[model samples]
Target: MANSNLPNRIIKETQRLLSEPAPGISASPSEVNMRYFNVMILGPTQSPYEGGVFKLELFLSEEYPMIAPKVRFLTKIYHPNIDKLGRICLDILKDKWSPALTIRTVLLSIQALLSAPNPDDPLSENIAKHWKSNEAEALETAKEWTRLYASGA
Candidate 1:
């Protein structure tokens, strides 16, 4: 809960992964800003997000580990998890966050979310509406948009 603890956790996890290896996540800090980072997560295969590369920006504030870090999509992705503004809707990012939630855990949770998206609890109302009204069409649209924007169609 002290200053930059969240970033420190991220940095440590990144260092650990760099030293070892973690699947589906590649996290690195920007040379200019240690508080800002660039992260890449391989889309969960067999899910609507499969074959997509999710680019994300993570911002850790001075008040960290107490307040969860801010994470947003840098890529144009269409999913129930992400809103149009790229803000991800996850409980861990919100009310449920604890200092114990590591970057790896967050990324893994995202992958799991792709497999079981909670359209009932969405960041984007429009996307949620589509998801509620026409699930198949929404999934196809999400998949198509992912191919068009996140992947080379």
Candidate 2:
């Protein structure tokens, strides 16, 4: 059976995200499917990803709030913690998730991840190696990728 509380919770959260929006992020639930959302995150200032607007998809399951939402990038990003398929290796999205966390908090965490990548625990080994071995070049490549793929904003 569908969780009766899930839809109402999702609607409240979506409304909050719209009203008091974060500085560089915006998301809206799909009209056809309230469980799916189209998300856009602007690259944090002073980060290599700055000037880019990345797209992502977030889906809430019936177990949401109790279980973490599923999220993935739709835009290509050159980051050590995000795989080519756009899967992110963030703790909150995995082992650290809590029912108290909201979509706003998760998106904020993602923005923080773009600002500070952890190459030691990486999703993209090649990008991690590049980040550790030649950070300057890696940053440049990241900027180039942002310009090519996510420069809409």
Candidate 3:
């Protein structure tokens, strides 16, 4: 069974997200399942992903507030920190999650991750190696992927 307070928390968070949306990011709870959310993140400007709109899904579990929400990219992106499976290499999404962090903050952190990828700790070692070997080329490929896959969304 889902937590009794979960619905209230989800409702309040959804309302806040709709009322005061974050720049370059938007999320809405699914009508069928309030625990599921459809998210869109506008690629940050000045980055390789600029001018792209990346889709993502976020699912809050019954243990949410005690555990972090599950998030994964639906859009294909050529980023060192993002894997082929669309799992992001972010600490907050893993062991660093805190109950105080809201969906908005998580989205913002994801946006920040897009702006600054840490090749030292990457989801795709090949991409990380490419990034390390030739930064310009890696960035170009990322841009191409953004233009190819993420432009239409």
Candidate 4:
């Protein structure tokens, strides 16, 4: 599809994302599908996932701006808030979503989630339990997983 057919909001947003990307984050629309984006987020320093590069997919539906963009992790991560299938348990991505939010905000939120994993509201019960039971071990596991899968090498 051509940019001529896309909504002005999407075009502006895409331009802003490309021109002024957020720190440690990069997002670009797919050449084949303007509505689909390929995203990469570098793990925050001091976090268990540090030095890792996580990939994600974001797709804006036809009702975008009114509806939250569909997003999912393409890289494996060992975190309580992320499930085995990479589905994330985040309020902004679900019930708390608002049209005012943008893709930059969403990706920033995901990076924050990596910095502060909320085991209390988790997507993976087992990981959550592990987090609650033995946090140090859980952090080590998360670090190991990041090294193994999200090295970006």
Candidate 5:
């Protein structure tokens, strides 16, 4: 889509995202659709996902800002907060979402989630049980999944 056709807010945000990208994160709008973005986020250091690169897709609907952008992981991950289908269990992505939040904030929140997985509020029941019962083992499994699927190799 042409820049002129998009909302001013989208244009400004897209430019800002390109010019001043967040650390360990990259988001670029698709040539075919300005509302669609291809994103990459490096796993935070000291997290089970460390040393891995995760891919994701983010789409801004016609009701963007008023409605939260749809986001999902393209890379396979093992986390209690992320389901097998890559649907995330983040509050900000759901009921806690607000128009005040930006794409940068949402991505940052996801990175923080990776750093602190909340098994108590999980999207994957089995994984949550594993996390609650044996955190060390769950962390190892997460690390192994990251290595196998998100290594960027």
Candidate 6:
């Protein structure tokens, strides 16, 4: 009963994103599974990730809402909180998740990460070191990646 309601909730949220997306993000179902999703977000203009569309993939489990869904970037990006595997280092996605949080919330958080890079807890040590020592250069690389991979250049 309750255990089988995963697909219904997943469909509802997926439909919600399609119906009324946030200011700069879009999402759709993945080819392999309805439980899996494909998403893209236009970088906010003031952030280093600007002028580009970043891709991410999401996987929602039956226990979602009770447990945080799994999310990973499908596109290559450079930032202190994102690793080579596209895993994001956000507390809410890990230990700090609240049952009330939704896919929309997670996407917004990633967008926020772009405007503010938190080197204190990083997914890439090298990026963190550079972000701390030479912020300008680090932002340049991130911006460059957005220009290259995300902007279709």
lDDT of each: 0.78, 0.93, 0.92, 0.94, 0.93, 0.85
RMSD of 5: 0.9
Q: Write the per-residue lDDT of candidate 6 for residues 1-153, one digit (tens) a residue.
A: 132445566767877988989888887777567777788888888999889888898888778888998989888989889999999999999999998898888888888887788999999999999999999999999998988889945
Per-model TM-score versus the true fold: 0.87, 0.94, 0.95, 0.97, 0.97, 0.91
Pairs in steric clash, model 6:
none
Superposed model 5: Cα runs more than 4 Å off: none
How high a TM-score does candidate 6 get?
A: 0.91
lDDT of 3 by residue, 1-153 (tens): 233455677778888999999999999988777888899999999999999999999999989877998999999999999999899989999999999998999999999999998899999999999999999999999999999999964
Of 2 and 3, the candidate ahead on lDDT is 2
Better of 1 and 2 by lDDT: 2
Shift of residue 45 alpha carbon in model 1, Å: 0.7
By lDDT, the best candidate is: 4
- What is residue 103's positional error in candidate 6, in angstroms? 1.0
**Candidate number that wins on TM-score, 2 or 5:** 5
lDDT of 4: 0.94
lDDT per residue for candidate 2 within 1-153, as digits (tens), equals 233455678878988998999999999888777788899999999999999999999999889999999999999999999999999999999999999999999999999999999999999999999999999999999999999999985
Candidate 2: residue 76 lDDT (0-100): 97
Which pairs of residues collide in candidate 1? none
How large is the C-alpha RMSD of every model relative to the true structure?
Answer: 3.5, 2.5, 2.3, 0.9, 0.9, 2.8
Worst 10 residues of 5 by lDDT: 1-10
Query: Higher-TM-score candidate among 1 and 2?
Result: 2
Prediction 5 TM-score vs. true: 0.97
Counted clashes in each candidate structure:
0, 0, 0, 0, 0, 0
Question: How displaced is residue 18 in candidate 1, in Å?
Answer: 2.5
